[model samples]
Target chain A: MEDDYYSIDSILSENQKIQCTFKVDIPDMGHLDGGHERDIKAQSKIQLPLWLAFILIYSDYVDFAVPTPFSSRVRNALNAEAKSVRLSALVGAGGHWYGFGKIIMRLLDDAQANEMSDLLTKTFRDRLAEVIDQAQHFAALGPAGGGGQSGDSALAFREGLEVTERELFSLAQESAKKTKQWYESTDRLRR
Target chain B: MALPVSLRNSITPPELELVASEELVEIIPLISIERTAFISGAYGPLRPPNKAKLPLWIAMNLKMKKKCHIVPPDWLSVDFLQNRLAQETSRPEFSEFPFRFAEIAKLLLDVASDDIQNSDKVRSLLKDIREARQAKSRDGLQKIDHSELGLPNLCSMEINEIRPFFVRAMGVLTHLTRDPEASSRRLDV
Candidate 1:
């Protein structure tokens, strides 16, 4: 569960990076020796986490790779059988599903990647609604009053899991909306 | 399988923490005893028909031994529990109650259902309240509204049932508003 580390802003502040390219050639800080410098040319592709990449990208120091999870593969999977596919498996495929999605959406907005952002938002909203439906269905199956001994206990446990899953979705969605507001407001401030 | 290990551990069922804090019931001693020593203190010299205000644990023990007849707690009355149940169902919110009202009621019902007046009604009402609260919590989880996080009275088992969901939902809301580092920056402003 990425619940603890799901904040997009914190992810950006952390040193993790996604793939990137160097825009400038600079001298090594410590030794100041050309031998140590090993002339790194501009436009050299580099891989870094989203956190580090966001800093460099925001600063115009480097351009980052398009976030991996927002690729054609994920889009196709969602369009093909969005409801049937388990959201946990999708999120599991990429370690930071909520966090990364948020970061990429923000980055796209900054870069004016409207088409990509729109696509991602539609896919995300659709997928999220499906997951909510699944949770509701799971909860509905349990014994309402919980009278029977063995069967009721197991059902109750399942109901708890379903409720928690729904809670996670609500949390993630709420985070997304908050981050969107923060990013939009900050953008306005910058202007 | 997607559930985190930490979450699974967090939901590890709450254990019943029975304490001898209150003199819950009185017991009339049928047999004579020189003295009975407890960690709290030594009680009684010789008694036959002496009513002692004993803690629930000791009273239950004495009652089990057939050496005394137990006087049940005041709230164990069926009318009171039924009123509480009605209040719970009629209102949109739950009110504050004894920490483990459900657990105490269950214990009393199990041990001396016959002893308590209108025991069947009490049992049924408790079950109704438990079910209503559980359903409410489930719906509330889906909404994820902090203002709506009302806790109804719960037994140990019911507490175990809702604790994980409550903690997880609240954790998400707390993390959402602000990151830790961001707060430090705000303090400077």
Candidate 2:
């Protein structure tokens, strides 16, 4: 998913860090962990950007932990009520939860990858209705509403949207606006 | 890879209106005019007091110039719209309607209200019909699946309204479900 050379989101998602441990000793790279040591020992863990981790993990030089965003607790909460889960909170700022999930699933083996992918798809399917509803709601309110029309719950839901969902929200919003503008801009016939 | 933003994905409502304008409409010309040709094809010989068939744009132009009285389409009347509004509200599925009804309705009601009987009532009924249909479409969107959604009677405007959402949501679904093992196998092969 991060493979698109021209996509900004793809590049940004590739830069997200994941936890991994070196499988074999590597020389003179200890400062990567923000330490003054001269070498990285085998089995020591540190966060690595996904782009580099992709190579090392696939080549059997590093092993990654399941990132917290896709951990069972978050998965359970999503399963319980997907629309209320603050997906952004699970992943933190500047990280796209869906985007990172795809890369992580790729890094895992067949069974685990399948489980995570299924979770991802189901979560999106459940929450998509809410996202579209909010987009259309905001579009109807127009910018002049300053987004206060839907009140606190909607604002909270909006703030919790990950970057991918945010993009989808705006696309839906712009489309709604275009339809409304077309409706109102017609020339009235003079009597 | 490179395309203008305005022309991407789905058609805009204004563009839909342009398409709707090509639909032929009935008009009673108030003055005589010779048969004329335009790029979209020929129309005219519009004579006084007798009805003529012209493209909606031509009818609108003549109407705006006080050269004709645009005849509102049958569906633009209060009774017809009331019936549709009843169907729209009573049924879960979208009521069958003209593919470009919203665009055409706007064109007629905006400029030719005088020619339409019970114009205000007609306007309100159109609004009721639109609102009823919009709610149904929103409900349909909520029920959307990754594989497909059966929304058979959706009009051009309704479809356009939901296009961005449907496209983006499907994009996410694809991203989530794309096979990773096969891809990695191919990549590291």
Candidate 3:
């Protein structure tokens, strides 16, 4: 729940430092006619290394940090939807608009894109429900009151934590692998 | 690290040694520019430049030094530097360069301390070096050969030890072109 693993602060600081250092303006080299003479001048001001930039940009969807204005706009839109849905007369209409717009729209439109969106929504919802169920079950089994049953409950909680950690690691590994493959495929296009 | 005795004692090939010495001397200022740019928050990105640009920048700087040409006036434009710094800091990468961000940072600090302590001497030296280089180009004469300048031979242990640093500096230049923002950020850091 804390999201401590992401270290967003460190990443942000690092980003700021990078911004201060490298001058990224590329001069229009097309007009320079001389061979190496022109090439050297053009070469001097390049900011990022091509291979690294290529890798970072093409790496993964989740890795993409939304540019500032877009993020703020999206947040405002989501907030507006939540307000409108809460005020609606129809039962569950607010939830539908605030939470399940893509799903309800797909169910109504019955188009291919909608269907895909529905499928994804359903999958995510099911997975989230499963996680909540597991957590609730553990929480219901209150702290040990000094008995064999209590000891068993503690063991169960420990096991659950281990399982969850493992799942998180597996997810991270899978994401990294997918990103690597995506980068490799896109790198070919740049060449 | 102290140079190996064999390298220290070995006589350098006159031509190649001369070239190497000249390269070493010319490289100092380029390194200075990079360091200054970095400390002044001019280096764009925090990340290292890509491999291609690294070598190219080094080669270009070397050529410029050899030709006694000034870096284009626009090279250090503020807007360009700021943009590049933004990019580099936003992304981090693994590189083959021997020194990482921490090492480079330390080196820069050491250089800055030494430079500030000898500000006038360094400034005068820089002015003379630039003037001499410019004069050579204007007079249509070959510049002072490395040996004539009393530089240590290219094959000398001291020079060899400094080679990697030069390569790293060159790599920074290359990164500047590829991810200016990242490079700029790294410099700022």
Candidate 4:
């Protein structure tokens, strides 16, 4: 219910690139990688948008490398301190890191897919409490909530959130603000 | 999808309060009136000093118009909220509260604080209980899995607060666990 077919976040996530190694040469497709030679050669690995990579992989023309956002390095960082990792920086704009992983999982064997899934779920669950806390504090603080060092750190944390977590943050903040609105609204009526 | 954030899969706090307003509460009438009838139900034949049961919205309206004294729900009092807050902070599971407790409490306290005994302390106690519950809920969510979660006795407003995050988290879980072979086959078609 949080997403739809027309969701811009999903669209942005699907635009993430995956590394694909060509298994068979295709004529007139060198333009895929700037078209310097006019023909794509066999075994040439190229980074292509996930949607394009899916088509190529399914057609038996290419095999995908695990996208760097879901790489072992990231797995280690997530295992180390999931809360401090900048998920937004991991997958470029919109930062649907989990969404991208799910798409990439469709191209993996079961064992590898499960590992990736577990990593993603773990990262999401681990950072959630922090996300909620930050949202609540910010909502409590209002626009003027930012103050000195803690505010700077909070701002850093906000900028690091991926799209899904950011959405949740805003939703929670909105809930807090609306609840506050009710209090002030009826405050005058109390006499 | 193009709709505003408020229209997302979430029901807002105020909307829940509106729904809570439909719940019946006891009110002491200040003037005589014949029994009245409206869409939700008919009630009254109110004479002076007699307590009558009416929906919270009607009660609030009359309280605002000085026609009745709204009697707060039993759970909305200072001692009860204090007891519940203690249980909330001390226990892992949520303490039992009426399904619409948060909304009902807010509406009552806001509109008729004078009618409620120890309204200021009750209000602060409610805040403490709320913060305690919010912390507990956040802590509980850390163990989120695709399987069943055991958070019993969560009130409507609490559920509303957590619903969006859970829905999306569950969606991702299902997506992650989907059979890859089947997914590729679907892509083939």
* Number of the top-ranking candidate, with TM-score as the measure: 2
Error of 2 at B67 (Å): 2.5
Tell me the tens digit of each residue's lDDT in model 2 across A85-105: 988887755658888899887
User: Candidate 1 — what's its lDDT?
Assistant: 0.52
lDDT of 4 by residue, B1-189 (tens): 798867677766777888988999999999878999989888898887988999888888888888999888888888888888888888888889999987787788777889999999998998888889888888887777776677889888788777876766666566655555685676668
Q: Please, what are the lDDT tens digits per residue for candidate 2 over residues B85-113? A: 88888878888888998888888888887
Q: Which pairs clash in model 1?
A: A16-A49, A17-A48, A17-A49, A17-A50, A18-A48, A18-A49
Each model's DockQ score: 0.03, 0.60, 0.01, 0.45
Q: Give the worst 10-residue stretch by lDDT in candidate 2 chain A.
A: A142-151
Model 4, runs deviating above 4 Å: A1-5, A149-153, A187-191, B1-3, B147-150, B179-189
Estimate the TM-score for candidate 3.
0.14
TM-scores, all models, native as reference: 0.56, 0.90, 0.14, 0.88
TM-score, prediction 2: 0.90
Q: Which fraction of the native contacts appears in each prediction? A: 0.03, 0.74, 0.00, 0.41
Q: Is candidate 2 or candidate 4 better by TM-score?
A: 2
Can you tell me the DockQ of model 4? 0.45
CAPRI quality band, candidate 4: acceptable
Top candidate (DockQ): 2
Output the lDDT of residue A148, model 1.
Answer: 44
Sort every candidate by TM-score, greatest first: 2, 4, 1, 3
Error of 2 at A117 (Å): 1.5
**Candidate closest to the true structure, highest lDDT:** 2
- Per-residue lDDT of model 1, residues B7-38, tens digit only: 45333221232542343566677787777788
- Candidate 3 chain B worst ten-residue window by lDDT: B94-103
